[model samples]
Target chain A: MNKVITINLGGNAYQLEEGGYDALRSYLDAAGRRLEGNPDRDEIIADIERAIADKVRGVLGANKTVVLAREVAAIIAEMGPVEDTADADTAAGTPESTPAAAPGTAGAKIPPRRLYKIREGAMVSGVCNGLAAYFRVDVTLVRLVFAFVTFFYGTGLLVYIILAIVIPSAETTEEKAAAQGTPAATAQEFIRRARAGYYEGMRTFGDRKAHREWRRRFKDEMRDWSRDFRQEMHQHANRWWQQGGPTWTPRSGAWFALPFLSLFLGLIAILGLWVGYTLITSGTVIGLPLPASMPVWVAILFLIVVIQAIRWPFKAMRRSYYCGGYGPPCCGPLGFLWHLCVWAAVIWFIYWLTQGGHSATLHDLAQHLPGKLHHALSSLKQWWEQL
Target chain B: MSVNEKFSSLRKGLLEFLVLKVIAGDKVYAADILQELSGTEFATQEGTLYPLLSKLRREELVDYEWKESEAGPPRKYYRLTAKGREQLQETLDYWQKINATLKNLGLKSRP
Candidate 1:
């Protein structure tokens, strides 16, 4: 007997059997997720609910009976498979316009079962174990069948060899899950459970004296294997070095220009500082006039440029401070500070330019133009007047 | 792409316009509209139709009011708004333009 559940869809109550209710709820949930980012998501869902309610009515007709699971499934099928709906939207060439509401629907469909060798249970070959697993039979029974076949004819050996060669081993967690018809959750969980079961089976001989024994044995096995691996790696490394293997080293001779570059950068930094000092003192830096006199913002801007110029060489020097295999030198904090100075200088410079600095600077620049250019400008002006 | 898939996609695009045209002709419930569209190429699943109606209503191209039914639960009767009429006219003009262009090119309008 199936339990009945009451559901509210589109402001109307529906009487649905438990299976139908679950299917409808999941379908609707999947649809909701598919249309999550849509602006009219709520309206669309509401409309879907109304359509479902109408479907329920059509199925029930005058009987007013509880809806069945098959009825719900039929309705969902008519609505079309969730994945198909998403695919159609994509195939329609309007993915940007249509949001994928059913992200989980992609994985909901189970892949087909495949045959895999079960290494967990095998005496001669994993063929019997794999066949048993595929058919959900006892491994002993499969072995008995092979034994009987061997007595009748020598084809059993050849058959077992062929099966073993063809079938894939259930080595990974996902492969094991596929072999056993179970969904793969995590490799760690699968490995832990497999180890615990294997050890438990082994400990059955001693009447299960200690539960912690299995864990200790597993850890010791892992440790021994790692130790042997490390020793082998050490031996290989020594052999490689003896055979004249190349080692990573910085090209010290290639960086011979560092000193000269540092000197040139230092000179530029000093010039910037001198220009900033002149601007502070006489409202002009390197013959470029400031806005009227030295405003606080302009002075601050000039100081920032001078400081950045001084820090630039230092930053570049740090970039190659520790080369070779040590990775790139970190200038995170210094870079952040330099960027802050640059932004402050830019903002202040823009403020100064907007506050009557444009005309004053242009006047100074225009007065410094060459005689030939000034004469060409006058001739062009006279020709334009005549035209 | 196969011919069937192309036709399917072409039909899917026109569904919304065809539905709006149906509602513009008369104020009708979902079942009635479905009945009218039955045996026609414009026929679509209820799941596909309802959401479209709701979207059109949201866009202010259509409006609906619930009325109690004799057979079962209340039904939402849908009618085209003034904006919907204007949209329908524009859609018709666009369709006519395309049809005329296709005719001038000596190609069949429907495939």
Candidate 2:
């Protein structure tokens, strides 16, 4: 069974077989490409579709409403190829050239088609027409394609609306000409070149009128340049931050904490080294006896403090690298809490060492320790006594 | 160029003049213009006529008004402007001169 597709042609609706729709759509597209940039683009396409719709209606009598591919092909053949119609127009314009040159070839120098909504004959935003010209498709078919997409997903409307808003309207003849990629210098560019006296030098003229013309063009060029510059600056002001330009947003909190973190890390390093040096040479750390002959608990606590001090800087560096984008390991308050934990761990280790050095605490810890550790401590005590 | 190509160009050269002459006679719609040209060698499609009409309109040689039609849609009724009449007169005079010259040379312009 053939699937039927609904299509709106020249304000009239018809249900056509899917294959017939494709055939008709492609035929219309060919016609549209040939007539791109013509002032009567919309009217011509509408007329063709109207004629075809009338023919299709005749073919689909009172009983059968479905239009098959063969019927569409027959209708297209009766209408004739779009190129013949275009040729007739071209011949009307330039009678000397039989089989007029393709619209796309502009003396072998076709400029890239720029996106611009044509001002004249625009329905709604003119995006569909502009796109049709750019893609060399029928405006009607382009609109139909957009309608289908919008019906299925609804993104087509959003995209079309955004394009309509963003694409500048081609208000002037020069803009309309350039919209079709005709390599014509814009008025601004012409004025700039004239002011530079490029064309003036080529002409063998050293007259006052020539100089006066140059001065006038120079004035116009300067005015246009200044206006464009002001407009650009105004636009930039709105999106300066996103473009990575200079902005007034306050520095991130990380910037403020960086110096403090460096200072704290340095202090911890110095304290850990001082404690280690004092314990090794003078048998004391922070005015507390944390000697090599202390209880196993005090020794283990000192080892942990030294290891943490060594690992702190490397861990912070890794965290910063990861926070750049890789992982959300250290960020804002979480980072601060991590630093607080490190500080607390170091201080607690220091406090434990000071108390563990006391003879009463050592004896308490000694009783709780395993018998093997007690024997080892007693042997160290005997050795210290001999020394 | 081939004979066919030359003939195509020859036919094309007369289309605008013919179109102006047709519009000058009566206020015509696009379909009417095509129908009138159907008997002539200048018979063309609506696609070609619309563009030419619009170009003529832009040049102030022709003007059109959107008139409600009993047919399918509102059609653009086109009429020749004063500028168009003057252009048609000039073109006709030139063509007559050319035809006279061709006749003097023992060649007739008419098929």
Candidate 3:
């Protein structure tokens, strides 16, 4: 005695076996997801449901009351996969649209590829496997490339973390199909691929063994190349020394440092001007008689400049890395200027501390406090009398 | 490419044209249309036909009327609109032109 459930489809109640009902529900849900953006989605779905109901009635033939799972499967197959219906709609819209064909078949068009991290057979996060699948390259090659890049300032580690966050995982059958560039047009296709473990594209045992062998060979080749490179470097150094110790041109050496020197000098000049203005106005640079509110504003300005100075280099580095180049030369020169300003600010702050700026400001405040306090008390008394 | 895949893709491109032609013949029920094409290469499932018909209706190339059915609820009987007939005629003309071009090319290459 199988469990039976009554479902309302196309305004008619039909008794379906539990398994059959689940299958039908999932199929309709998938179809609904596919037709999400269509204006006539409800009508189309209704039509499909009505057609299914009509077919179910024919299958029943006044004898069977409850639809069986086997019958439902057969009915679904005869009606064709949900993807075929969706694809037909899209194919009409785009004249040259390629219908997704089942993978591993001759003349099958590979589905448009998407990067999705695989969960199965993953070493760390399935980033490398995802990359390998997308490019149709060996997983070992991708892992090796990442391993090599990691040696350079841990760039690969940073990139991996970012990709892990940004690239979605292959959670759904459709997403898995997209990750592998395969077509899971039908439920049967998905089941077949799942049974074959096809979604575990590149991290199988055989591939792992091959990767180990490749890594060992790579290490051997690297050792040989380094030894040869060191020998060549030694020979060049000896030849250079024998020719003439080293012709160090003063102009050439100074040319590179000139920009740094000018920027430093400019920073010092700006600092000196600021100090002079404060000294001339306030007898003690920090004893400016301005309202107490001014200090907070100045501190906020200082903080803003400091944070911007610190953030510039990291932003530039990220941009250059993601943009796939050494980035603009302005990044280097501007970065130096920002650093110089930050250093200047630090030195000026230290100078102020050492020069008793804090004490002088305190002293100035103390002098003004009593008179201000007396004035405030009198104003309070007058306001109380008026009240 | 495999011949089967090529044929299917070709059929897919021509399926809409065939659907328009079928509707142009007479006002017909969806089941009747399916039956008419069952023996031909243009035969398709209800799942495929319903969506195609829905798209056609949305595009204003076809219109449907709800008519009482003998056995069940009111059924949608479809017929081509003026725009649909115009589109069908244009497609037929284009197909004929291509057909003639293919024949001419075949004749020129035969000897």
Q: Worst lDDT window (10 residues) for model 3 chain B?
A: B1-10
lDDT of 1 at B86: 96
Error of 3 at A156 (Å): 34
- Candidate 3 lDDT, tens digit per residue, B48-96? 6877788888889999999876655568899999999999999999999
Per-residue lDDT for B1-111 in model 1, tens only? 555455766777776788888898888988777778766756555545665676677789999998887654577899999999999999999999999898788555877
Better of 1 and 2 by lDDT: 2
Q: What DockQ class does candidate 2 belong to?
A: incorrect
Candidate 3, B1: how far from true, in Å? 3.3
List, residue by residue over A1-387, the lDDT tens digit for candidate 1: 455789997677888865566566656755565565666667667767877787887888556678876677667655532222323453331221222322112223333456888766455337788788778888889977765554322234446655776898887544555676654322223234434563345335444545355446546744754565466567667876996774434357535655666677677667755665465445576777766655746565656666675666565653454343333323456554646444454444344443442545544654576775888899999999999
> Of the candidates numbered 1 and 3, which has the greater TM-score value?
3
Question: Which scores greater on DockQ, model 2 or model 3?
Answer: 3
Against the native complex, each candidate's DockQ, computed on alpha carbons, is 0.12, 0.09, 0.20
| List of clashing residue pairs for candidate 3 | none
lDDT per residue as tens, model 3, A100-184: 4221121123458999997665665689999999999999899888766655434464577668769999976557668989753
Best model number under DockQ: 3
Model 3 chain A lowest lDDT segment of ten: A100-109
